[model samples]
Target: MLKFFVVTGIGLALLNGWIIWWLWRALEHTGWLRPMLCLVVAVLGVSFPLLYKLGGDSAIEVWLLRAGSFWLGMLFYVFMLVLIMDIWGLASRLWAEPPVAPRWGGALLVMGLPLVIGCASWFNAANPIVREYDLTISTNDPVPQTYAQSPLILGVLADMHLGRIITAPRLVRAMDLLAPYKPDAVLYIGDIIDDHILVDVEGMAAALARVEPRLGHWVVPGNHEYISGSIKDSLDILRHSGMQVLRDQWRILDNAFVLVGRDDMSRHAFEGTPRKSLPEILADIPHAHRNLPIFVMDHQPSMLDEARTAGAVLELSGHTHFGQLWPFHWVVESMYENPMGLLIKNGLHSVVSPGVGTWGPPMRNTSRAEVLIVKVHFTQTAQ
Candidate 1:
């Protein structure tokens, strides 16, 4: 906990420092611009976090705080772009006189670009595009010929981050998109609730109750479930809503495949529950089921080798929203071998979804919001 606090302190300090420096360059004029820049810096860098923590739980107050955070994040990116252009203009003037434009033209350009881009991003996030993948998890081991009799269509939705941005209407849209597939089972990889905001637990449960499949509706907790020490509370709510909450447990589906759900890595850090090792979880599954094709639901892209070693043929995961924004996906790419797609390594297949809801900005700049409609076949290859 001490380490966490120290790291958080350092990060906030650095972020505030950068905001101050950026404001200084972007608004150098002394008259009214000085106060305006100071206000912007205060609101964008410091006030949002502080207010978010202290704000009341009333719907009005929550919306105010959320809106402040969203627009500030959007404007921050705009400020960076505009500041870069300004620096380039100044550098060019050192070598040759630059073409003159109206004083207000620069201001409009700086403000207009972010406004246009921000609106588009908001629309894109509000309307998520369906992304589908057809994969075959093949194995050389002796398998049931009955598995080839039919394909298992599994629908996966992850990282809903519900509370502020992901409301019932948005969730309904995702359900509507996945309905056509008529999946036999739906596995929800967690973050179903937003940690920082006050959520209507009953309302969320009611909305989720609408999503029913023929076989089962399963869910695994993500890092957000442990947020604010609400893991157990959250689990109870969802369980009451007809979801089979699987925490380090496995369930057989149609006698053809075994579904294993792992507790999020944060269980120890946040919930004080020690997570079971992959081998321990695998030991419980009958040997006959092992060869029948194992599909594991791990929330994050960790413990790949352990799952593979345990004979898991497929793993479904989320938590890297493919960076959930532009240029940031580059950073996410460096972190995970398969950030957002189907990856097969040594016969272990992993599919990581980009997630269905927004996290911070409520805007997906380049990253798409999607649910995975995966067709799992026990065949020789991806064909």
Candidate 2:
């Protein structure tokens, strides 16, 4: 961990230096503007994380974090653009004179594009979509006659980073979107709250009370739950809000299927609770449920293979936000076999939601915030 942090710190410092260098070049002609911009950049680059971790009570602090998160999100893309421009400029020197210094107009455009994209992303994040999928789990036994007419409809939601950005209205909007599906059960994959500000926990109970998943409602802890440093409080809040919290446990749902929820991959990192291995959890399954379709709820997609190996027919997860931002999702996609959608490998099915809510900047670019209505059908095949 120390080595990881050291490397990360050095990488960020270099990125910041380059960004500052670009800014200086672009605004050099503006006199005092360059120094002032530099100071602002330095302060934000240094203090945003501190402020975000400390959180705040004042409106200024809230907006500061919001703005800081927005800028940070934009910074990566802007840095890439600036690097490209710098490379292009350097290469042109061999063919022609080092294209004269950039004009103010050009600089402004370079800066403005990222902000434009950020604003558009903000709007996109506010409007979430409901993505639906129909899945069939073939088994040795036929789907019970009782549920054949009504295949268990499951509503899967994850990464609802409910904080200042995702307020009551957004929660209401998600509820409204999922209500039409009339899910038999709704599962919250995790990250219910971004942080534990006093205001965050206030209306949570009331807000969650409005969610109506017909059969049952469940949640598994996500990294944010522990990172917020309020695991106990978060659990209490979620329970009060009417969702069953499941951690490394399995619940038999009307004997029709088994719902296995795992702890977030970062549980030990943040909370010191080592997660149970897939084999261990599967070993505890009752003999009666051994042949039943088992659906695993894991907060992160990293544990996909384990769940599949455990003979789980389906696995539901979130935490990727499917790259929530353009190019970023590309990074996320490279990391997982199933980053944002369904993946079928050797008959094991995995569905990863881009997330119904978002994290950082209240923005999404390459992906849309989504609630998934998964219709699970149990079918029997003759050997």
C-alpha-based local distance difference test score of model 2: 0.80
Candidate 1 segments exceeding 4 Å error: 1-41, 44-47, 89-104, 139-149, 379-383
* lDDT value, candidate 1, whole model: 0.74
Give residue 380's error in model 2 in angstroms: 2.7
> Which prediction has the highest TM-score against the true structure?
2
Best by lDDT: 2
Q: How does residue 61 of candidate 2 score in lDDT?
A: 78
Write the residue-wise lDDT of candidate 2 on 1-383 in tens digits.
Answer: 45765686577678778877888887877999888876777665654455766777578877777777777778787788888778877878877875756556656776789889999998888788999888888877667885777777888888998876566667677777888777888898998777767434546655555667656789999998887667888778778767788888888887788889888888788666789997887788888778888899998999777877788889999999888888787889799888879988877889999887888767888888888899988888667
The per-model lDDT (C-alpha) reads: 0.74, 0.80
Taking every candidate in turn, the Cα RMSD to the unseen true structure, in Å, is 3.9, 2.4
